[model samples]
Target: MNDPKLTPQALWHCALGLLSRRDHSRLELSQKLRQRQFDVELIEQALDKLEQQQWLSDHRFAVVQVRQHIFKKHGPLRIRMELKRKGVNEAYIEQALAEEDPDWFELALVCYQSRFRNRDIPDIKEKAKRMRYLQSRGFNSDQIRYALEAEQD
Candidate 1:
């Protein structure tokens, strides 16, 4: 419904309501507005206004998300994938990943200790389990092995 009567003000209000709760990519906002049947032009106008005011920023979103993900022990690969899914630009994702410096080995060891504190297993089984766990959390094999080796030391 590209109703000219559907004012930009209404769309802006709706968009602000959504943004107030959490960060969203422009693509995500566009899709939501489309489902609401707002006029495409009106929605785009509102989005442009928001961007002009710095209320809608893909770079800021990427930075915040990457920081939080790393803090929660997520690896760069997983964080990058998530940012891409959220429609962040490739250059922004690359910059954000480069800016983040996490101690994967330490974090992985901590995670391993937390998950298998009292458990005992053979070296092979333990390594396998650790590999699976870290990999599932989006860590590369190298990081996982380093962490596991650190645990063994």
Candidate 2:
């Protein structure tokens, strides 16, 4: 249970402990603090202090998340959705994505080839299945089509 006498310093220390483990967007930190039964005003004050001290930033979190997702070979669509879910704003998401200039089409091709290199594409059904797999991996329709066509060439 939350003590009615919980001080702002206590709440800030709790927030710092969470931040020490991993980066968190402001909203995510607020939600976690709230779950611990901290008062809303106290949580806001703690978050403001963290932001002021430059120890918390949604922009930094988005950048790190985007890089990690790209390394995992997840596509832009999936990455964007994940960032949105993490309470990152559109500006930060776009800025983070813009900083990385990978060729998505080629990336999609590489991802497809890596997964389907040994398989035989024998029929329309099989090709369609492969296309669906690529789509599920977050490649856009153009990127999927290009990757499939590249396989035929």
* Top lDDT prediction, candidate number: 2
Alpha-carbon RMSD of each model:
2.4, 1.9
TM-score of each: 0.85, 0.90
| Candidate 1 lDDT over residue span 1-153, tens digit each | 356545676788889988998888887888888887888888888889888999998888888898988778887778888988888999988887777766776776676677777545577876687789888777888888777777666
- In order, candidate lDDTs are 0.80, 0.88
Model 1: residue 133 alpha-carbon error in angstroms: 1.3
Over 4 Å off, model 2 = 1-6
Q: Write the per-residue lDDT of candidate 2 for residues 1-153, one digit (tens) a residue.
A: 257446777788889999999999998999999888788998988888899998999999999999988887778888899999989999999999999867889988898888897556799999999889888877899999998888888
- Pairs of residues at least 3 apart in sequence or in different chains that clash in candidate 2: none
Q: After superposition, how far is residue 6 of candidate 2 from its true place, in Å?
A: 4.2
User: Which regions of candidate 1 are displaced past 4 Å?
Assistant: 1-6, 123-126
